[model samples]
Target: MHSYSRLHHQSGHAAILFSLFIPVLFGIFTLGTDGARAIQDKARLLEAVEVASLAVAGQGSDNVDLAKQYLEYYFPAATIQDSDIQIKKINCEDNDRCQDNESRFFEYQVTAKISQPTWFPGNEAIIGFGDAYDVASRSVTRKYHSETVDVILVADFSASMYNRWNGGSKRKFLDLKDIIVVIADELDSFNGYMADKSLKNKLGIVGFDYYTSRYNNNTRYFYSHLICGSNEKECTKTNPGGSTNSVNYSATVRDIFNLNSIAHTPWQKREVTNISSFEDVLLTDDMASLKTKINSNSFNITSGSGSGTAFYAGLIRGAQMIYQQGENPRQLIIVLSDGEESNKNTTQKLIQAGLCKTIFDKLNSQQQSNGDNVKARIFAVGFDYNVNNNPQLADCVGAENVFQAQNRDDIKNKILELITEEIGHLAQ
Candidate 1:
């Protein structure tokens, strides 16, 4: 009986020990799982805050309330009470305290915190103590207005331009609008002066197409009648609005849309009148209006691929415009098209036959000239069914200048990359 009682006592002690250890093991397991979840939540919140802050800074929103609203949209579950965001704009000169350039770079810092309640006895008790939980994440972006670019858009509105490029869902007309809106918005970034007094660049546009019915002056380039009003008078009695001589845009892109229009005259009377300057208008707005017009007019791609695709003709005209300015400014030609140049001789058999190749080769040689100091880089975007097959059109703007996109997103990204790279080059 004494031995049996001693054995029973040992067994009871062992059972008690196991019971104590069971809770400790279970507590540890639960803590690990819950801790992982808390960490994930914290990381997600930090990312959300960072993105929100960037959006606020990019939009140039001064109202704190709007920022808060934007934050909620990005992080639907995260409360502003749990996060702190601070924004600072430092001059490029003051960036490293070197005071080298006056460009402004905005820095945004976001700090977020959240607490999770513990349920286990030890952890639950510690919740009342100072040991809740904490995690951190960080991201940085630099913003500056360091350079200005005056762009001359040369769009291709030729007969062969009928294409369904955006995944067989969008026609050329629709896609062009999408491209314009994006480029214009990017161009608007040029404030010329940043918060830190850095210089932001400006953009200009020149869209071209066939509308070449009248050309009396036969001037290589003619100022838009839209700018100064009636061609008959220097300045019209009507408020001629803004001049379309230099249309401003924010982003870098190709010019396929030509705003050149023939004077509205009857076909019979056309011979009687001697035309001076056939106005090739593009845009007239300085800021938001330009952006709005691009968005509005993009979808309105006119029918009838008139005259023909004057690929190099447009380039020559654009280059001349830059020359007429008399200032040695940085010039870039963005050619967005299918790259098929029409044989003008087919339409006018008696006209000069070899002009296209002659003109094209001259421009090509000039672009490749080693002594040319003017920064003129051309970016040719092609939507060819087979990129390798279409060498002439794609190669017009130079090999380095060519960019082929598969979709709208790809096109947008490539354009942004090109513009950013050019800006970096200018900074140097």
Candidate 2:
């Protein structure tokens, strides 16, 4: 009877231990499953905040309300608390907020938190912790700032650019001219809004054409400089409240460099030709000079000569000018091409595209000795010419960034999107 009683006592102890372990084991199971699910939800929450930050920064200053909308659109499953989101605008002068030199102008800061019920029984039975888990994230983006930027327009002056017979009704060069002015105006306006005028974004122009050698080697021809006869005046430009007046003088077909005389004639009695190859103007903030380079009569005189780019030289030339500035300001290389006939082979075209990409990679991803990829973004525009069999261009500058505008109106709209979405986008 004593032995039986001892066994019953041991059995009672085992039953109590088993009951205690059941809740502890139950907590462990819930922690493993629900904890992992919470981690995944946290990641989704972070993605929502990141995307919303960019959209709010790019769109405007409406703030937390706008960000919530973006969050709902991007992450509908997230459960947000009323007090869990914050958006703030930062000014560089406020050293407390804009501590880093990179955030030198205006900034948009976004913060978000996701809260959901916790399935872990430990919260109620043992730990007395809250019945929910909070997953939170934050993102900061720059808006207009005091950043100095240099914009280079790498334009195509190929003979094809002078034609209208291919699906296009207007001369491609003229259409390109309208596009150039629009871009310049947008950039200038960006500069105008800057609190510091010295931080003006500069503009530079490059006109490129393909040149073939006697050995059949083809190279890009850059309009390096412009000149005028001792007696003739510079071409007048068409601007607001400005009337244009020009004297008709003989046009000359000089050698590629204008070093040797080839032929002389007059086209509708326009300005004298002192244009030559390899005379690209460096970056400048002067609008009149930029307009003159585009409006000059010789600028439009594209006869049956010149077809030189493997597609990268113009970009390289433009980038070189930016490097010369020494300010390490933000840089943008705007490539303009109808299409190139010289790069006829698919492999050949992609090779040229690779060279262009290398230059772009270098220019956009400039690094300090410590290896901070300045994290700059680049955009490219592709206007449709009569013969744009050069779809290879989409590969040149990411397909999304390339705007294949069919008409003048489309060109303006594309420019608007480029300015709005990507130009000053410094988000990482």
Candidate 3:
């Protein structure tokens, strides 16, 4: 009987041990799952703060109210209470202190804290069971501001331009016109807005054909006989215009830098050309003359001997124009081309000159040493050009800025998208 009692006692003791361990195991599993979930939520909250703060930093005063709107759009769960989130230029003064010297860098400082009840009964001990525990996160992001942009559009107005053989030939011409109008409209849209209130970003247009020329009140060769006024409506009108005895010029072949010598396309090679000569290609009242010439077939591609694609020249001139606009502004060149450079110079050289390594290096050196902040982004488009053969050209613009369109239908949409993106960046 005693032996039986001993066995029973041992069994009871084992049962008690097992019972105690069951709860401990349960607690471990519960803690593991809930802890992981809490960690995930914490990470998400931190991300929300980061995204919201970055959005605020990039925005203008008019857009500050909309910053939170973007944050909610990005993170619906993280509710922003009044003054709970703040963004400002990174400076010593942000912590309520100011420096005698100027602040060099700007960052988006985000502060957020969250509180929620514990899920498990025992978790109160780990997460302040009796009261809610606060989970807070802080993050800072640098500001990307486009102080100024020197913009130039190198358009193709070659003889092949008149080729009616292609589908939507007339539409192609209109597309170019629309592109010009769109760019002008975009610039005008940004007209009094600037990152620095004191800075005024300048805008210029350079049209290219066999040649390249800056568009002024006298630019011609495509549509409307009158050089387009600063306003979009004036640009669209077909009349002789504001009628102040103004002279208009058409963009033509010689204005562009021709790579081929007489043996190939007939333009002198290695000859240093002046901007004034590039300027002279514009004919007073050139648009009217261009329309007449286009109708008459006088401006035909076969009419010209030069086949040298002066793309590099256009890029160089465009960069020059940007540089001339004061080193303080950003420099951007939009190069539009349809076909590969036929008998012209090597395409690689042109792509690299202003779009690739050289420009970036130049800007980086200036920015580091002098805070010139003169970086420029190129938007290279190969319209109807064979993608495989010409891939390198657009690639030189950097993956982000390069663009391609299978045909004319995609041109306007793509251009508009790029312009819109840039505007957003500028506003930020």
User: Considering lDDT, where higher is better, how would the candidates rank from best to worst?
Assistant: 2, 3, 1
Number of the predicted model whose lDDT against the real structure is largest: 2
List where candidate 2 sits over 4 angstroms from the true fold.
1-146, 165-169, 211-279, 304-310, 326-328, 346-354, 365-378, 385-388, 420-428
Candidate 3 stretches greater than 4 Å from native: 6-24, 48-146, 157-191, 195-198, 213-310, 323-327, 344-379, 383-387, 391-428
Give the higher-lDDT candidate: 1 or 3: 3
- For residues 1-428, write the lDDT of model 2, one tens digit per residue: 99999999999999999998877777777777778878887787778877887776675343576688877775565577557889876655654554445334457778888766666536455442246777788888776554556667777666667666343456777777777777677666566556656667677776655321111124322222111243433323111001232222132111112322221111121221212232355687776677776666535635544333333435545555665552435566667776563434522333353544555665666764566454334455655633346655556666665666666656665554444443355554
Compared with the true structure, what per-residue lDDT tens digits does model 1 show for residues 13-83?
A: 99999887876677666677667766676777667656655654454332345445655664555445433
Using all chains and alpha carbons, the TM-scores for the candidates as numbered come to 0.46, 0.48, 0.44
Clashes of each: 22, 11, 14
How much does candidate 3 score in TM-score?
0.44
After superposing candidate 1, which stretches have Cα over 4 Å from the reference? Answer: 1-8, 33-140, 162-189, 192-331, 339-376, 382-417, 424-428
Q: How well does model 3 score by local distance difference test?
A: 0.46
- Selected candidate, larger TM-score, 1 vs 2: 2
Question: Per-residue alpha-carbon lDDT of model 3 for 51-76, expressed as tens digits?
Answer: 66665554422133454565566455
